[model samples]
Target: MTTFADLNLHERLTRALGELEITTPTPVQASAIPEALAGHDLRVVARTGSGKTAAFMLPMLHQLLQHSRPRTDTRALILLPTRELAQQTLKQVEALGRYTFIKAELVTGGEDFKVQAAKMRKNPEILIGTPGRLIEHLEAGNLRLQDLEMLVLDESDRMLDMGFSDDVLRLAAECRAERQTLLFSATSGGNAMEKMVASTLREPKSLMLDSVRDLNESVVQQVITADDVKHKERLVQWLLANETYDKAVVFTNTREQADRMGGVLVASNLKVFVLHGEKDQKDRKLAMDRLKAGAVKVLVATDVAARGIHVDGLDLVINFDMPRSGDEYVHRIGRTGRVGGAGTAISLIAAHEWNLMAGIQRYLRQNFEYRLIEALKGNFLGPKNLKSNGKAAGSKKKKMKKKEDAKKGKKPARKKPVAKKNSRTNKPAVPDTNSGFATVKKRKNPGSID
Candidate 1:
């Protein structure tokens, strides 16, 4: 029953939340907002669609509102990993700060650089952007954070995954040393994340609301086995044709697969669009817009859309190709079952991808629901033999041979000697060339020998 008001947020922010019909604070918001308001740097690990945007934004905005100063430099900088996420955060900022006088501007790629430079000249109090474009603005002398008060690294793990660690650290360096930082990610991004935390954050309060393995509990996960890519394609078509969902996203590991799947789905007369790294900004924006507007029910995309893109009524996620890691799988399915809403995630697994899927399941510490579509079932019914850990069993011939040898008390066989070849004739001989070096001769008696 804890509410935003009990968390001591700004009146204006509470009013904004009220207008938006969000009365209660999510677990992350309730836990994080208080610490951030107390001027502590935070490292938060929460799942996607857990109101993380509000958790950091509310505290930053509350502080900014309390200590209003007339300045021409940006006071707060929120760095995201992708343009789509930047744009989405911008909308959320506008929505949350509607009643406040604080101004925020977005500077991401896919927009005119000169225009962004012009906006930077206007001196928005809050600046939100991706790392690469923000670095450009910093180097070009178009943006400055010397007087910044707060810094938020939303989706820090994704930024690191996209190879933006250096740029992010550099931008953080540009800010004032005393600035408050809030870093959030869905997964514990292993060593790279640890390195980032060491380099960027000070003595920080760590909030782990949800672990990566237990994320998206409201979404039921199921896997359908397939024979090959062709079988997966048919499975995808069948799911889109039969599955019940308001909006669904089909994830592929590569852009080439996304493009190819988009074509395959489109040819089947399905309303589908493709989004990936290679797509132009306009196309990316258009795809998201159409998906949100209900103009398209399905979107085929790469991991680019996994972290940032948020849409209501998104209740289904299909893995056209199994994601490479457990973290990536979490983000892919995170597109659906946001907040406390219910949804379903189905992954189409091929013979080659069987072990990959099993690995992800073990990483998450949860078993997926095995399903079969009778109408278009494929030959792959999973591996005949499985290890206790759920992975496909490997060949045991070598282990059995070693056990047999131990029982018989037999010594291991030694390798045969390799044949040496003569240098001139290139034939094997008793006295062979010493790796093409001539043999040396010595005399027993140097003085008497001729």
Candidate 2:
């Protein structure tokens, strides 16, 4: 319920936020900005849409404005894990800090390094970049951090999950060790991620806001079984068949899957876009621009590309594939059902994937309330040609029916039970990796992601 004005943000930054009609600070911003303003190193755990960016951004911008450092040298650095998110964060900094001389240069992958270098020569007060390119610039002597005072890792967990931990570690080492490092991630649990945070950050002032990591009760979860990609594609087409949402994102595990699903959705006559690492940064930005303009209604992306994609009022998120782990699932579905709007997360599971799906369900400790969606089911590979006599088919069908009846005989067949989740790290489904099944679950938060 606190307003941005109550946070004691600078008048200029507050005006800029006001121009965007952002009046109140999200929990992350409200809780974190003051601590950051006081110059404490931080390891913050908050959800994707919790406005943590502003938590750090407002304070970092204040530092630039307060210090009024020369434009020929950088004063602060923000190392993000992805180009899109770095770009997104950089834009916010630039927009909010426009009234001041605090320039923010986007140092990321896929763009011309020469252009980034030229911007660097201008020595902006803040540098926002993905680890690799920033490191590239650093190695080429295009960047220096001798006077750097602030460093932020937005989505730090993903930096580790995607194998960028070494890059980030290296960059952090290069910066002044005395500088404040603000680490923001969705998970700071007992997992490997939490360890990374502990190992990197100092006795930082940490605010453990797990609201976003919980099952945003606002984002409904409806699980479905799809035999294959075709049916899942059908499910998406059917879901969008009516086009109720202004925008939605379908998540796949691989870039190929994202590209294929995007094409299929477009062919099904939906306005769509695909975003992933394989595409150049320009393409990714184009896709995002289109989505923001509502030129594209469906965005298909992999987990890497989807992180930190901030779109307001995104009504739905589809897991074209269930995440390999619960933390990933929590972050992926978080794209929607944000900021108090109603949202839905639909995960399509294959029968063989039941092992994984079951692990996920057991993690949530809730058998998903599955709707058969029979009308939308695809003829998965046109149904495998039967290689049996009619009598054989009849016998198998009869036998299966009897087994189902027997299963039903155990008790009145009941609906999947829903558990109140505390957090992703609270409970886990026993995993068998040799069988390729392991899952962790978080209790459903009736409110939001932590």
- Please tell me which predicted candidate would have the highest lDDT against the true structure: 1
Top-TM-score candidate index: 1
CA shift of 126, model 1, Å: 0.9
Question: Where does candidate 1 stray beyond 4 Å?
Answer: 396-450
**lDDT of candidate 1 over 305-354, digit per residue (tens):** 99877999999999988899999999989989889899999999888798
Which window of ten consecutive residues has the lowest lDDT sum in model 2?
A: 385-394
Q: What is the C-alpha RMSD of each candidate to the true structure, in Å?
A: 11.0, 21.4
TM-score of 2: 0.80
Candidate 2: residue 37 lDDT (0-100): 88
Query: Which segments of model 2 are wrong by more than 4 Å?
Result: 189-195, 211-213, 365-367, 377-450
